[model samples]
Target chain A: MSAIAIGLTGVTKSYGDKVVVDRLSFTVASGECFGLLGPNGVGKSTIARMVLGMASADAGNITVLGEPVPGRARLARMRIGVVPQFDNLDLEFTVRENLLVFGRYFGMSAHQIEAVTPSLLEFARLENKTNARVAELSGGMKRRLTIARALINDPQLLVMDEPTTGLDPHARHLIWERLRSLLARGKTILLTTHFMEEAERLCDRLCVLEQGRKIAEGRPHTLIDEQIGCQVIEIYGGNPHELGALIRPYAQRIDVSGETLFCYAPDPERVRGQLRGHTGLRFLQRPPNLEDVFLRLTGREMKD
Target chain B: MWGRYAAALPANAWNWIAVWRRNYLAWRKVALASVLGNAAEPMSSLFGLGLGLGAMLGRVDGTSYIAFLAAGMVATSAMISATFETIHAAFARMHHQRTWEAVLCTQLTLGDILLGEVAWAASKAFLAGAAITIVAAILGYAAWPSILYALPAIALTGLTFASLAMVVAALSPSYDYFVFYQTLVLTPMLFLSGAVFPVTQLPDAFQQVGRFLPLAHSIDLIRPAMLGRPAGSVGLHIGVICMYAVLPFFLSAALFRRRLMR
Candidate 1:
């Protein structure tokens, strides 16, 4: 394996009495997209903050780009770019000015920033909105500009926190495409998101975190195959308990919710055959996804 | 706790210049309007109190009330400008705009941001003070070349108030919280600091209180220079201003680092 771009060992962080990040350990290899997937209040952003040295870990060590965090974080940050979850763009400046100013924060000169800004704007498809104020731009445009701003210093590691959370499908796809290009260019990425599909699409390897603990870690597909199965059979309506009992014989695992029974099996046809005579129940069988793995590990409960 | 805070402060002082430049670039967009807005208050106070009140009150000490008030206005304007910038504007950048958060993600530390903000606020206050000083000079209320000597005093006043206000900004949860500081602290400081009236005329208790207030020392240094008179205990006034400027700066930097790094 290539050298680790980011390494966290038994890292723990807490706010007062509540532990935000438990003793978690993970590594992101160089030139790969790594995802930290979890639900809200599961300490995804907190972990990202620790890596960036915005917040200190209560215990354990974090090394980014081979430098100890919180101590040499400023040196590490010079090679790392960050896109926070919210739009913290300088609304006081125009789109281009924001990039220029952000570059200066990294100690980049005006000439250096100017040389790369045009190409970056082109990459983000924001060439036309160069003179537009941040508030004047659409939600997608602001997000794109923020991404472009992050790249202004030509950072080796890109740390993004839910880059596409509030974006529309079109905007999300654009960001995803841009991220793929960055990956192709060998930029190491550390991404955090609750969106399972985003992880499945982008991450070469991922870890599922639940309430500050890492429950599972592996490639997306491998995690799904191990935690869940190759296929999921979701049977809706009509006596969930009875249906669960019927499907239990053929399925590897079974889960019961309010009106639905989810049966995970290596072979969908075997589960389908078992439910052949169940005319009163509505059933759907499809390939198990990361969502199924997430649901299985984290449970299907809403988090505020 | 002090050791941790000391560690959190920036090792390099020059790093704050970038943050100062960032603010300057943003302000450059509305340069004219911002300058005019900053100047209007002290300008109006100069005319209103210096002329209208001057007509009724006549001379203060050895100099005319307009001349005395002009010098005091220089310090008061710096205080007001710095207070508003650090309290309201810094609060917005820190919380609403999240500009400081973005800056913090880079190589700059919280200390850099704090110093940069204080520097920027002081710069704005200096401009406001200089403008009113020029107006006072044109109105014949200031001694021509001697009044220019008050620039350093005005700058120090700016730093003192900006640093003091930053402590408040670090603690403030919302915009409304500033009202308490403005009314309870700033309003009292303005009146007691001999900005609008003579400090000696105040009661012995208020006079004793004024001695500790930064603005009182600021006006004492500036009032004499603007009137072409000998400044009394110049070193003492400058030392007091320096203490206010330096101590609150470290205090506020520590406060901001604690607030931000958590």
Candidate 2:
């Protein structure tokens, strides 16, 4: 087999009595995109931190860039870039200055850093924002600029934690397009996000975790196929609390939420009869998707 | 492997240089205030206490008050540099900028980053001391040979305090802790550490007690050097100053490492 860019064995982490990442093992091959799928509070960020050497694991081993990950991991961290969940951009510095300063952290000369900055700005579509202070940029602009900053070192492995979060649909798709383009060029990427659609669109393979434990693992389509089947019948109106009594006889599982009920079954069409006599109800059927699979694995209840 | 580590020093230094640039711009008001405030305290003390008290008191070990106060002022500048650098500037880097965290993400280790910070802060402290000394000389209060030794003496004090302040910053959970140190620790030490009055003026217990404080030893080294007088007992002073310099750095490095590990 060819070399793996990242390798891990039973990596574990905990805070006080609360375990954040529990005995997890996985690896990302060189020149491939790997998605880390998990619900909020499932230790996805914890794993990412361990990989970055930001946090040391309480147990187990890992290797990154052919070295023991987070231990003897000698690959210059300057050769890796991280897009944190929250923007840590220097507000005082202009977009270009931010990149320049970050480059200096790796000992890059001013001449070397400046020469590469323009192309990174253009790649993130923020070329016009070269002189603008980071604080003046909008959220989408900031995110894009962060992506550009991540590429300044020409990183071998890029780690993104919730990159598209808190963005409009147009911005999200633009990010997706940029990410796909990166993958096409054969860069190794590790991604973590709350949005399932992003994972389905970008990940080659993913593992889902909940409360610090791995719950499911596979490609998005395969996980959806195994957990949520091919069809879903969504019913809205009526007292959703009574949905179990109304739809349980016909559906495989009845998920009562707010004024809507999710009837997850092998055939959505066959479940329409259970709701036929129901009063004050509207219903629709759609194909199975990554969102359904995620909700099923992590529960559809409101998460604060 | 060590080549990469060595290469990262300049990288780490660059981060501090960038921070220094931004800090100078963002806190220009504070910098101007530091320049003025740092200079003013010494000058005013020289005029008020040194001149006023010296006219009445006659002499300290037989030197006039204006002359005596100028020597004290040189020591004061060292204290001010250490105070401003360790408390105000260091606090902002830890709390506002999160500058160290960003720098550590590179190939640079924590040790290089600390050294860079200490270097920059020490440079600033030395500048303030040198500026005050120039003013003292213009007023004809300085002795030339003592002035020659003033730089090394004050520079050491600057490192001592910068390292000490870094420990304070690394260990403190908030900016309030810095204020607490300035008031409770730094202020008393400044007055009691032989800056204004000679430790000889104090009672017997206070005189011997003075030897233990890092600032006292720093004062012992800086004052006599600025006055062209012999610095008493070189070995003890250097030993005490070096202790002041190294202890806090070890503590701060350990603390920073603990925080980063989390």
Candidate 3:
């Protein structure tokens, strides 16, 4: 079997009365891109911190790179690189300087860092930005620079938490592309994001987290097939309650709008025949995806 | 483990130059500012106390008042600066900058990092003391060739305080605790350690109390050199200074590793 880059079983973490991760159990295999998906306030960052060995778990075991955590984690950390959610790039240094210093922290020699720095710059698509002071760079440039720093160790397992957060569209896509390149290099990736499209595009397999628990886990397409059905039709043009009432007979699951209704079934087209007598009904049918799974699990409890 | 880390470092002479070059590039302004700010306190004391108050105190230890105060102030400034360097900057690195979090993650051990920090703070303290001596030169202190002795004396003083500061740093919860150390420990030592008056002036009980602090031996070793004279107890002074050196060095390393290291 390929190396297991990360593993956790019966892992629990808490803050005062709040149990953030309750007996959390999971693992990510080497050379795979795994996603940890959750909405806001869902302890995703807390889980990421624990994986990085920056925070203590209240109970249970955590292993990375085939070794028991904390003790083995020290060795594993040197081999694994982490791109934290916030961009804490050393503002005192230039973009290249940031990478250079990070390499220094790992005790990378000057020439070795020199050799790796250029490739990292190219990977982040900020080769032209090597000389710029980190403070002078734009938000996206700084974010990419932080990712470049994480790669200086050539980590076998790359853990990135919300790596593209607060970036422009172009910057976000650039970061996504860079992440994909790392994936192609046979690097194991553990990534967390709130964006469904990102999860769909990158993760080979994923786990959905809600309220400090794993709600579901599977590949994107399989998750969509099993977690949500063929399609969801949301009708918003008419009285949603009445529309919900009218569509209830046709849908396996009918969700209401004030004036329109969603007819969810394998054959949503059969809704046309069923709705033939109804007039001025409007709706849109879209494919099932992570977002639907997310909503179906979360139940819109004020994401906060 | 260390070998694996060093294997990756720049093996060439150019690489060492670059590491220090970057340190200088990033910190030169800080160096200049620190040197001036550290020297200024002694300068103000030289004018206010050495010149102003010395007019009444007259001769001390057979040297002019300004000259006597200058050498003592040199030791005081070095200790004070070194203390602040490790306490303020190093603790900030640990807690605020999260710098140490990034540092210890690498190939470097707790020992190497502690050594580097001690060396850095000590070197900065040496510069501060050197700056005060320049002011001593303009004031016509008898010491001239004594610059050689000044080097190790100031370094000893630096090591003592730097180690003490590191211990404080390991325990410090915030900047306020450092200010407390200054008020309670550093400030008292400056006035009590014979920085101006000789230790003999204090009571027998107080003088013996002063014997335990590192600065007492520090001033004992420094005064003769700055007076441009020689005294007995070279062996005793050297031994005490070495204790000052070895004790804090080991303690700082051990404490820093225990407190900050994983």
**Candidate 1 has which clashing residue pairs, if any?**
none
Clashes in model 2: which pairs? Answer: A62-A69, A63-A69
lDDT tens per residue, model 2, B182-204: 88888878767877777778888
Best by lDDT: 1
lDDT by residue for model 3 (A254-300), tens = 64423445556677877666666677767678887788777767664
What's the TM for chain B in candidate 1? Answer: 0.96
Which DockQ values do the candidates obtain, in the order shown? Answer: 0.62, 0.40, 0.22
Candidate ordering by lDDT (highest first): 1, 2, 3
RMSD of candidate 3 to the true fold?
Answer: 5.3
Each prediction's whole-model lDDT (CA): 0.88, 0.75, 0.74
Interface C-alpha RMSD, model 1: 2.7
Alpha-carbon DockQ of candidate 1: 0.62
lDDT of 3 at A272: 63
iRMSD, per candidate, in listed order: 2.7, 5.0, 6.5
In candidate 3 chain B, what residue range of length 10 has the lowest lDDT sum? B3-12
Could you tell me the lDDT of residue B23 within candidate 3? 42
Candidate ranking under TM-score, highest first, comes to 1, 2, 3
